[model samples]
Target: MTSGSLHRLTAFTTTANGGNPAGVWIGETLPAPEIMQRIAAEVGFSETAFVAPAIGLERTVRYYSSEAEVSFCGHATIATGVVLGESVGDGLYRLTTTVGTVPVAVRKRDGNYEASLTSVEPKHTAAPEALVTEALTALGWRREELDGAIPPARAYAGAWHLVLAVAEAQRLANLNYDFEALKTLMLRDGLTTLQLVWRESATVFHSRNPFPVGGVVEDPATGAAAAALGGYLRAEKLITTPTTILIRQGEAMGRPSRINVDIPSSGGIVVTGQAVWI
Candidate 1:
């Protein structure tokens, strides 16, 4: 229950300057829920992860944002995986999250540690017309700017997200929105973040995640959202299965991050990124 138990790290970084910062707390037993919330708020990251021992290579994990506890968080999970790899050996570790059980593999590649987590079963549903209109209004976006090929959807892969695809990259780059308005809408609809994206190519995409629910303006690297996006694409038959796609995020925020997603024919999506000790 002390600050000394907390470890600060950055995930999905290509360099030290890039990536999303997260606090990882590894303890023999988790602290009380209120204590965890206080620690996460003090850390003030988009999300903080708490880890405790389970069976053999399994661990019980919890995620909390500055505002509240999250069902799942990808960047924080990656940060925790790297920390575990350093303490224990590099291998596969099972994480029991609030949403479901996720399996993360940690390994050292080219003298750097990397982690990949397989998401829970992902599902996507058409967003309600009224909700979409409200979200666009809050974001200061017009309906015409949307990409017709990719419709707006409510996607879930451990966490919920509103997936909005814009027609142009510049549209995605200009991310100025009413924080309070968007936060209110997200909270009402149980959305964790707004997955605003622009497609650069068939296999490449650029994304920005607005995480007002987490008490943060944006998330630099959002693994859970990325997994939901992958599932959405697959379920909609927008992409061929058994393919790998790359997502570039946080460029506008000046902390560039890279996320690699491997989509299989069935089952969970695989999200990969690197973490560094801060």
Candidate 2:
């Protein structure tokens, strides 16, 4: 963090302003937790990923919000990959996170660098009844407003998120909620974001993320959540295995982002998208 120089990148979009933006900080070693949080607050993105690669097999990578530390971040990982590709040359870069070692593959795609990360083994669990009730209460929605197609589940790829599927797209758009209440509940439950989604079809889905826990009201494009959704859908047999699905996000906020998810049999889900400088 010397010289106060911070590098920024827009992940999940080939062109600038098309995907969620993230700040990437590459330093000799990770800054103090408080210092990283301060830098992230100044960077003012949904999430900032800091990478401090260790020698040999592990690379320590940490994610931070404007207010605190996060388990993992998808866009920031992609952004960090691109930055690593540019500086270290394109190849596989291993990021040792608080959870595990995350491998990111960076390559030149159509003249612009693209980074795709393989998440730590994903895990999903049933959403708690009390948390669901509190979330529904905060969102001003009732039980009937939810979609039966995708039941409530707390899914995790590299992070934990509660998935709530609404039956209609409009429900996903009108996102006014009690920020403090949701944040309190999320903090208590160790939630990263609430994956609010609408299933348009078997292959196409639209989503919104309520991220009060991150000190942000909403997340425009959420790669980690998308990966979690892919795993949840496959685990529940909601979608067939070896399926490629499209997740359209950020449209409600006007920064439309598209994430291509590939669910393979017996492996971590692969989420691919392009990013540009913003």
Candidate 3:
């Protein structure tokens, strides 16, 4: 029989009602992949993190959505870090994900735990005109509505994401798209999520992510995408180096999540957020 203790927590929001919820399963040893998949489906959250060797500072972590296994999940990692901190005291925890090793620093702030996870080396590639057109068609977005300043690109921190920046906030608010069409396009393009965003200011942004591939309509908070955005901006020279950006997500969906991204001159991007018990 499978064995693990499951904890439910929401990431990027302090309140119990906000943020993206995830299931954290801690066990001395990981169960079979099939069993983990079943547990993820049963959890019914956007993602569930399976952490093995529950008693150590360094552990192996795997992420699974309701549909399939994901290479990496930012919010789930944040939740896992807090869970580990509560159980093993506050410190740095190392997680070995399928993509690479991620170091997460955990600390108690305002009587609640917060985690900062440094992603694997981030990179980006230009999105071809044809690919951008197809993605826009799937999302029912017109090419003119896009921000010409921020060209479409495939950005990756741990998982690949299509970073599309719209020119207006209203366009992002009315997010209506064909779920199946977007899912098919994402699968074909090998995208984990579409980072649909609107630049509110020089260092502030608002975003919405369509995650049909993960069997979810939309993600309230997407940390991996946030980190990818930071890397994309730095790599593409869209913003000044060694700056921090704040991403406000889930507001359109009523969850109101906040993700803080710290970008250095080089190396991995750091994604920081808070998680609360659900």
Best candidate, lDDT: 3
Can you list the residue pairs that collide in candidate 2? Answer: 13-274, 13-275, 59-96
Model 1 Cα lDDT, one tens digit per residue, 1-278 = 53336789999995778999999998878889999999999998999999985225788999999989999999999999888887786899999998889999999998888999999999989999998999999999999999999999999999999999999988998999999999999999999999999999999999999999999999999999999999999999999999999999999999999999999989999999999987
**Residues forming the 10-long window of minimal summed lDDT in candidate 2:** 50-59
* Residue 155 alpha-carbon offset, candidate 1, angstroms: 0.4
- Model 2 Cα lDDT, one tens digit per residue, 183-257: 999999999999999999989999999899888998888999999999999988999989899999988887888
List residue ranges in candidate 3 displaced over 4 A. Answer: none
The CA lDDT at 48 in model 3 is: 98
Better of 1 and 3 by lDDT: 3
If the candidates were sorted by their lDDT against the true structure, best first, what order would they fall in? 3, 1, 2
RMSD of 1: 1.3
Candidate 3, 136-188: lDDT as tens digits: 99899999999999999999999999999999989999999989999998999
TM-scores for every candidate against the unseen true structure: 0.98, 0.95, 0.99
Model 3 alpha-carbon miss at residue 207, Å: 0.4
Question: Considering TM-score, where higher is better, how would the candidates rank from best to worst?
Answer: 3, 1, 2
- After superposition on all C-alphas, the RMSD of every candidate to the true structure, in Å, is 1.3, 1.8, 0.7
How big is the positional error of residue 61 in model 2, measured in Å on the Cα after superposition?
Answer: 0.8
Top model number, TM-score:
3
Q: Which stretches of candidate 2 lie over 4 Å from their true place?
A: 1-5, 54-58
